[model samples]
Target chain A: MKQRFLKAAAIILWLLIWQILAMIINKELLLPSPYITIKTLISKMSESSFYIALLYSLFRIIIGFLIAVVFAFILGVISGLSKNAEILLSPLITVIRSTPVMSFIILAIIWFSYNLAPLAVNIIMCFPPIYDNVVKGITNTDRKLLDMAKVYDIRPLKIFKGIYLGSVKPFLAAGMNTALGLAFRVAVAAEVLANPKYGIGTKLLQAKYNLETAEVFAWTFMILLLSYLFEYIFKIIIESRRYNAQTRKSDKVI
Target chain B: MLRLENLTKSYNDNYIFKDFSMVIEKNRITCLLGKSGSGKTTLLNVLSSITDEFKVKYSDFEKLRYSYIFQEPRLLEWYTVYKNLQFVLDNTHMSKQAIHEKIMDSLKMVEMEKYADYYPYQLSGGMAQRVSIARAFVKDFDVLLMDEPFKGLDPTQKEDITDRFLKMWRENRKTVIYVTHDLDEALYMAYDIHVLGEHPTKILYTSRNAYKMNDTERENERDKIWQILRSQI
Candidate 1:
């Protein structure tokens, strides 16, 4: 709660600064004040086009992120398990990591629609970090633990759940958290480039041309809120593992 | 039925043991006594199949399951001491109730019933090793292999652990093969001690029914075993 209060205080200070600066400039066309930005944002929120844009943009970017998660996890496990697979796929992962998101977004625009350009960029952005961390995590698991598991000759399912999953949880979750933030940033950047219709990027681009600085700030805040909301929900889900690992005395699984 | 016939094991062309052979009689404690470099740990590893580099002749039955207590406790750090036992028992053919019973029994043996819920990270070096001992005792394997299982322990802890281990061996009657540099440990625990010596390690001596319990004048026995180990070093 104290941390929340501090964050709120910081945002208030920044907004007040923006408002005072806009008053000094004294031109609504150049920079609307905070109240005007809020009014514009509230007015925009009531429009059906705004909701439609939000849904389409959210669906595409989120779908891209989820696909990347699955993609990284599967390949990461394969590379972790075998030397040959690591050698084969490592160059491709290196290439993905080094390539710029803008380059991919532009290439995707030529190959796909506006919706897909951002989606593809999001996918590319999310995969490399996740794959690298998970593979490293699983591979670096203690050899002694692996030996203990082998001596037991446990079932494959149990090996996955008990041994591999336990070893890779922190890495996997951390990668996802990092990738989540990058995904949203890249997704919007790609959107602005592709000029996706009815999206926040479209509004942002319009604000820039019209010189509505406060409206741009409002849209930026909205993007921040949405990204934070997504990350918060995901963090809760991942942290629940510590809870699930616990078993009750009543023989109930947590 | 436990036999290692003409087993040859080496590391980087340095032979740990060559043409070494031993037969462990069923349901008895066989102690391997040696200096630190005399290949006691290596031989134990070979028997437990933890060392795959060794070649053994005339031991066609390598399918026998084994439980090992290493020199290090090697307990999983994330789990409580009791949960470690519970988890190892999770996929066993034994019923849940049987596993719970075994955990309780093993915990009692080492006087670690109070630390059932403490994670391995929280245990001292000695306590962690005791939990490792308890884990092996509860596993219900055909054989138990302990390698310097009492390393870093003081005298009282060693005695308590050795007693608990012997009691476990009695209850389960699994073929127990324990390795240690401690001279009295072999004297205290073994029905037979196979003393190995250096440089292409081989059995220097063998003593059967070496020392009796309650004969606390262990000086002579300790010095004799110590001499053989020192000569190898």
Candidate 2:
């Protein structure tokens, strides 16, 4: 517990250094101090536009993350189940993984509705990571255990419940953690480029054009805060699931 | 009714078995006696029909169910004890009551009943092996294959498990093909013993050893088998 206090002190020291650097620079457009950023954030809290922009983009990004999770899991399962399917899907996943985020965001702007481009970009950003992790998880499942289940004529449902789900959980947790960060970053980029009217990205763009550098810093901090908030909550959910992930009991099916 | 005839296994010009054949008699304990690399595990794998490198042929078997207790426990590290038992139960008709009773019985047989809720990580090497035995016996297979199941056990634990195993087998009646390098173990448990010999393995020696002695006399015979085996192995 004392160790945690030291770590907290270390973080504050770094923040202080940042604040000092910002003050010496004395150019809000270039860098705002933590104080200015926090003040702007507190003032923005009273405005309904802040809530609208925040919730609207949060909702879309979460949807995008969920869609990526579902599709990645399906494609991962397909490839894991068949070597031929992996060979077929390999190039597509590679292309998605290697492509620049900005390129996808720009392409999505022209290809999709203003509201949907963020989802599209976020999905493109997320699927490859989740899919790769899940595939690796499936591949690493114990061969001996599978053989035992096979010889026993264990039902497919029971095999999945007892072996597959438990095997893939760590991978799923890791993938979700990774994809969450990427999804939020890409969604905001997509929103700014596509200029979705009520998104945090649109507010960022408005601040940029108006030279309200403090507001820009505030919005950026809010994005960081928002991402951290969602992750902390979801982490609890994910970790709670992890604690029981190995609590396997077979399904009774003849 | 498991039969292996002229079954051969080779890995990159290294042959473990060459025309090695054995009829694993039904409802009886068969032990294989030999040194390491004597194709003991290879023969067992062939008999189980899961030999990856072996060219196997079986005559008088039709879709036989086989469960194996590996040399290591091979328990899935992420699962609990009861879940591991459930993973291989072939019979779905056992009532919740019957299932619990049998689960308790099997775990009790191995003295692992208390650790039913423990994960594999929490078990000692001996305890894990016991769970593996429970899991293998729990699955109601026609044949139970054990590969050095008593490898790491201390003397008292080994004798205790072997005794409980015999009692259970007498009641359950499984075709158990047990492989052990220890001849003492073979003499004490098996009705028939087939010795797997040098590379390009063939039947070195095969004999029927009837069990007709008192407990102490049987154990004394085990020591003789051990003395003879130590020189040969």
- State which candidate has the highest DockQ: 2
TM-score of 2: 0.90
- DockQ of all candidate complexes: 0.24, 0.36
Candidate 1, residue A76: Cα displacement in angstroms equals: 0.3
* Model number with the top TM-score: 2
Model 1 residue A28 CA deviation (Å) reads 5.6
Docking class of 2: acceptable
The C-alpha lDDT values of all candidates are: 0.79, 0.81
lDDT tens per residue, model 2, A13-121: 9889989999899898899999999999999999999999999899888999999999999889778778899999999998998888888988898898888888888
Question: What digit string (tens of lDDT, one per residue) describes model 2 on residues B83-202?
Answer: 788777745687888887778888988888988877887777778888988888886678888899888889987898788778878988888888998877888789887877656877
Give per-model TM-scores. Answer: 0.86, 0.90
**Model 1, B1-233: lDDT tens per residue?**
57778988888898887887787777778788877788887776676666588887866237777788888887766567887777667545778787778898888888889878776666677788888888887776777788887888888988877787787677768787888877767887887788888778888887766645346446656677778777764
Error of 1 at B154 (Å): 5.2
Error of 2 at A158 (Å): 3.1
